[model samples]
Target chain A: MKSDIILAGVGGQGILSIATALGEAALADNLLIKQAETHGMSQRGGAVYSHMRISDRPISSDLIPGGAADLILSVEPMESLRYLPYLSETGYLVTNITPFVNIPNYPDIEKVMEEIRKLPRFIAIDADAIAKEVGSSRASNMVMLGAASPFIDIEFSKIEAGIRTIFGRKGEEVVNLNLEALRRGRQFAEENR
Target chain B: MQKHLFLGVEAIGQGAIDGGMSGVYSYPGTPSTEITEFIQENPLAEERNIHRTWTANEKTALETALGMSYAGKRAMSCMKHVGLNVAADVFVNAAMTGVNGGLIVTVADDPSMHSSQNEQDSRFYGKFAMVPVLEPSSQQEAYDMARDGFALSEQTKVPVMLRITTRLAHSRAGVARKEVLPENQLSLPADPRQFILLPAIARRKYKGLLESQNLFLKLSEESIYNRYEEGAEKSLGIIACGIAYNYLMEHYPNGTCPYPVVKISQYPLPENYINRLDQECDEILVLEEGAPMVEEMLKGFFAKGTPIKGRLDGTLPRDGELNPDLIAKALGKQMFSGYAIPEVVANRPPALCMGCGHQDAYVAMNEVLADYSKGRVFSDIGCYTLGALPPYETIFSCVDMGASITMAKGAADAGLIPAVAMIGDSTFAHSGITGLLDAVNEKSSITVVISDNESISMTGGQDSSAFGKIESICIGLGVDPAHIHTIVPLKKNHEEMVRLFREEFAYNGVSVIIPRRECIQRASSRKRNKK
Candidate 1:
């Protein structure tokens, strides 16, 4: 009945969309939710994170303390590793394999994936490729959300409904594309994990 | 009752609206910008014709809000902690003048300097001004306090400060809306000379302000926001202030901390609860979000009192935001840290966006300045301040808003010929105009580069007050028309921009080079909206 999720990614990568969808699902289920987001200067291509906590009980802190996150759901490969310390011993580290190589010192992609692979409970998926395969390349965050959905306590249908509700204003076409991306990502995690 | 998810800032905005606020004024800054933004977008505000718009800066915003309050309408002026510094003159004086209608000065402090230059606690400002300061521990409190803050202000006839740190300001939670109140009708203060703070009047007002401290304290003592929770354990008394209470409660999921807790959201320190805790417990641990104001007060100058532990005593680190883990550690709980980040994960500092005009502006400025000494470019706050980062580390200084021009003028005056002042359009509108005037009045030898991105660009592309008028403002400011050059900031115009920079740098007087373009983020969002 509780999930402490760390949504990690570079600024402008739409990690907040994932949080919004999850928050929608949590609310629809009549659960208490708290989300702390990074704003201002950090949003200018900086490493940004949102600490999202959902529980049946009243959530106290907006932040998920280090080593308490149920899921570290990240849109980028190295970005996922940035929040490794926040992951609980039993938590899942779900991240896209796509490396957002904005910085010059971005470590080797293979090496970064090697570290992710070292985790006992982790799912590394090519969310970008799957998102592109589904419809829009912009829906990679949704795909990552899908990959991490299994670890989240919320029902899958609620997450889908959440996406639909969030993207409803964008019209059905955009909604379906994102839903498809989500499904494809879930499928990838199911088979791989 | 229906519940809606709201960021702390959004909750305040909604609460203000529901509390019959007639106007909300602010200059956009991180964590605080969204408060004004929420009001600006609210349908009720639009229908009610509430005054919601970006001001030139925080000072103007507070002054205008004060003016609105003079007309006996509920008004709110919000700004980040640093913005309070700009508005301090009016803020401190407003206490002496008091208010006709309820006035709430909401200040969001940035602890850990998330997007700020300093981690100044605004609660100190509240204490300095001798006003009722409300710091909400939860979004619900934020909503309730903001909704009722006006009433408290009116009852006491002093501006109430609702202070929040970045965590609470940016965090989100479900907030139920309260019954909407009607705005106060237009009426003047009964005392015609109440606001006139002449020396003769000021002395009486100052005494009244001092005398009213007891009422403020009584209100704090009786405040619904402040609560005393008894615990069996008296070894440690914890004074958790504002959002720090949340971190303390996070440790005890069942909402039962062994130590007696004095949850203080309303300040004047609420001495009654603290006195009980002080007398009851063996030692006190002052848990607060920003600086150890409460902690210092408890310990006194000599630290001879109760064993007070906090940032001052090194029980908590001196700086940075507090987390549950830090609180747990202070409580003698086993720390929980998973794996350390792999050394390969690189630090990704914030940088100018891919198509940011600041990049081209900095590029041309760097190219031109490569010929001169490196430490010549003085910059102001905005997206252009990112130029101090890698690739084009052209800016030597990034101080407060509008310090660039004046600093450059000072450097130029000191014989650093052709000193460069790099600033942004929004900042140029904020305080840069005054500095430019100062430079002009002296005809100081400085090349001022106004990177006009047509928007604030920082804090999420808020509309700049100087939009479409940077050129005209410069011309009006008495900068020679021939000396002011505007160029498109693009690779194609790189040569031209460099040429203009070179020309202005050699002018030996106040000259301006404006690189005009729309912020790419704003441009892209505009296109998206168009679509």
Candidate 2:
């Protein structure tokens, strides 16, 4: 079955890279993929989301319905809740437990986390800690994707292929390090299960 | 296998690839920005050797595309609908010149005024320019028309306008890809005299463009873009054009909407489709966006229909946008009556983009120029015009495109001094250049601050026309280059900007200050990338 998945987050968390990997993975599995983004605000510590809809059949309405999404893939906690209404009641939320509370006017991190701790159906991971352990804070979203991906219907092989597409022309080490992060996330999820 | 998954904006770019456009010149504006951004980000553009660049503003983007066409390469320019007004001068004139290669201009009309100053229809541009226009109902059609727009422009020897609403521009769809046709790479005109706008040749070409109605109508009849979709003809027919067709079909799938529909994507008022639609149906309801262009034209060509309902004639509100719910209401279906509609007087206006340079500029202007009447601020169109809001309700009138500068000049002539005109660098190049020239030539006393943010920040951070040359131009225009001050629009330096304004106010003749800074949006974008 084809479903539309929207990944929204602030930039620098690799949101575009995630959308690219997801689109490639879906395409590898032979599903139709349509993804669009708004970059004007993405670069400015502002909200950014990639609307990705994958379907087995042709479709209209490029934007996902306000609250009919099957899964909400978010890199940050607040971003997950930002698109919560788009998720179906039974929809799973795959997100990181880290707080990126760097908004200009509001600078209190713990205050922001207190509010975000209340969302339902959350599969939270200390992505920032996991990414730091992996030698790159930039990989936090990838670690979260690694943790939450088991709940998705997409195959691991497809994600691997998609990851290769993103690593494009880079050294084997660069690709292997990210692969290790994905493995760590998957291993943690299975062991916890 | 060609992938079907593509964004509406990506599909538009791919359509440009298929449509054989040699270049896509645009400045980023919300909704419409992704087209150029995607073109740059994607690998296909480079593989095809397509020339896609972010121009300074709508006018410069249009002019650049026009230059490409003059060189005999199919070219396209794109922007949000309000940008049409910025490019209207060159845009309206481009119709007269026509082109050797195809020229297509796409405007993403932000209906409901989302990410816009006003929700205006680009259809008016088609009627104003006398050019054939096309509006796509879906992402598939967005791609299809983008490719075909070139053919239509070339066949008619006039520029083509492709219009899409915010939904279509920002939406995503599974667009099946077609093989890219090699573009028609043409050479320069054998005679350069043809395009040089000298009165002798331009007069003749202008007449030729006016007499092209028959050819335009012929092309309209043969249009592959606009067609009559045959369905069961009933007492009621649906005339859904552009994205309205997409929403209407979604609202009534399969047998529910068995009534015949005239899906007029291409324009010049497709008479054949309208004639068939009019002959079969007893009543017609026009479901089009941004003004009653089609509805008005249909009445002009044929008058026999009952209860023709649309944006005009009180069928729908004459202002704002049209959606399926409105269409449903017009078709005698009940719609959700929401919270009592807020009255216009009671409605609040837009504010600055939280941490925007425009806000800083407005704060400085309000503080320094409090002596002048609060309503006397001469403002140009941009996010800076948001100063007309609370906290800094400094702008008086924001009429036309670049009238902010000249409107202040008129005030200066009538005994207003120490007056200020704030125009963006991109807009200064667009139309403010000539206005500044007039002020300098006639010796009108005005202090104009060319807020040189190095880009057009409003329509989504397109390049600035005076990107590196604002100072040179101001000096060339006979204003002392010393008065051309630069300041980072930070609140801490409001005094510096304010002091520069104070000094320029004393200067009797034309004075310009170049407040140089990168648009906060673009600057923040660069900062995020480094992380």
Candidate 3:
């Protein structure tokens, strides 16, 4: 009945889409949700994060305190490790293996993956490849969200419905493609975990 | 009633609309831009034809809102914390002028400087102006306070400030709507010379403002936003202000703090509740978002009161924001922390977009400036400020809005010949004009680079007031027309841009080189909108 998630990625990487989908699903279930987002200057391709908390009871803080996050769901591999301090000891870290190499001094991809592999419970997914397999590479964020879905408290069907509601305006083809991307990602996580 | 999910800014917008706001004025800044944007896009606001448009700057925005209030229509003006500094003259005087109709001044403060230069608290401004300030602890309260803030303003015949920090402003939560109230009919102030600040009349108005302190305090004491709750423990009394209350409650998830708590969202310190807490507890802890205003006041100049502790006393860090862990640590509660970040994780600072016009402009400027000694370029607030960072590093200063031109002028006056001022089009419109006029009159030896991206480009591409009129404005301000050159900022035009920059930098008198291009982000979004 409670979930504290950290959505992390480089700005413009579409992590907010995952937040929107989760927020819609949480609200549909009549759960109290608080999501704190990064806006303004940081949106210009900087490290960005959104702290999302959903509970059956009234939520107190917009922020998920350090080490209280149930899941660190990141769309980028290196960006996932950036929020390790917020992840609970037994929490899940579901992150995309693709690196967003905007900075000149980005660490080696293998080193970043090594850090992620050190986590007690984590799913290192090739979300981009999965989304491409489902039809659109742009749906990578959806894939990452799906990979994290197993750890979230919400039901899978509700998440699908949430996606339908959010992407309803974008037409059925786009919605169905994203759903497939989500399903493929979930399948990968289920098999890998 | 079904709850509508809303960001804190959106809640305020909806609240203002439902509370029958006739007009909403603002200049875009982070954490505060969405309030006006929400009103701009709302169906009801459109149907009612309420005033919602970007102003040139915060000062003009507040003044326009004040004009609407002068006509007895509920009005709101919103801005980020620094914007208040630009509008402070009118803000303070408005307290003296009072209001004919309800006026709410909503200010969003960025505590961690997420998108700001400083973290100065706006509560001090409210206290200085001696007006009521409502700092909501939640999105629900954000809605309710903005809805009822106008009433508070009207009751006291002064402006009410609805203040929020960046966290509350950007955070999303469910907010239920209230029944929509009708906008007030237009009417004039009862006193004919009320707004006229001619010394004799101003003195009397100032006296009335001073006398209203008691009424303001009484209202604060009676405010629904300010409350005192009894607890089992009295060893330490805690005063949680605004969003800090939420962080405090986060520690006690069951909603029970052992210490007696005074939750303050309404201003003037809510003295009565504090006095009660002071009498009962051995020591007091003050929790606030920004500056330790309450803590300092309680401790006083002599620092001999109730063993008060906060930022000043190091119960909390002196700078940055207050998070739940910080609060828990202060309370001596068990803390939770996970693994440290790997050493290989490098910093990824915000950068100009890959195909951004500012990038091309900076490339040209940096190439031209390579010949000259470093530390000559003065920049203003905008996305171009990122030029101060790696890859380009063309700009030397990223001071306040429009400080580029004036600072360049000062440096030139101090004999740093050919001083360069790099400013954005929107910022040039904001406050650069006055400084440009001064430079023109003095014929200062400075090269002004008006990087015209044709939008604010920062704070998410709000329309720039100088969109198509930059050249005309510069010319009208008495800059020599021939010396003002325009070049398209693109890969193809790099040589021309470099030539223009070199030409202007060598000019003995004031010269302006405009690198014109639409922000790629704005251009793409426009394309999407068209599609």
Candidate whose lDDT is highest = 3
Docking class of 3: high
RMSD of each: 1.0, 5.6, 0.8
Tens digit per residue, CA lDDT, model 1, B22-47: 99999999879999999999999999
Q: Model 3 compared with the native: what TM-score?
A: 0.99
Arranged by lDDT, best first: 3, 1, 2
CA lDDT of B159 in candidate 2?
90
What is candidate 2's TM-score against the reference? 0.79
Name the docking class for model 2.
incorrect
Instruction: Give me the iRMSD of candidate 3, please.
Output: 0.7
| Model 1 misplacement above 4 A | none
Error of 2 at B459 (Å): 5.5
Chain B TM-score (each prediction, in order): 0.99, 0.87, 0.99
**lDDT (tens digit, per residue) of candidate 3 on A18-51:** 9999999998888989999999988999999999
Q: Enumerate residue pairs that collide in model 1.
A: none
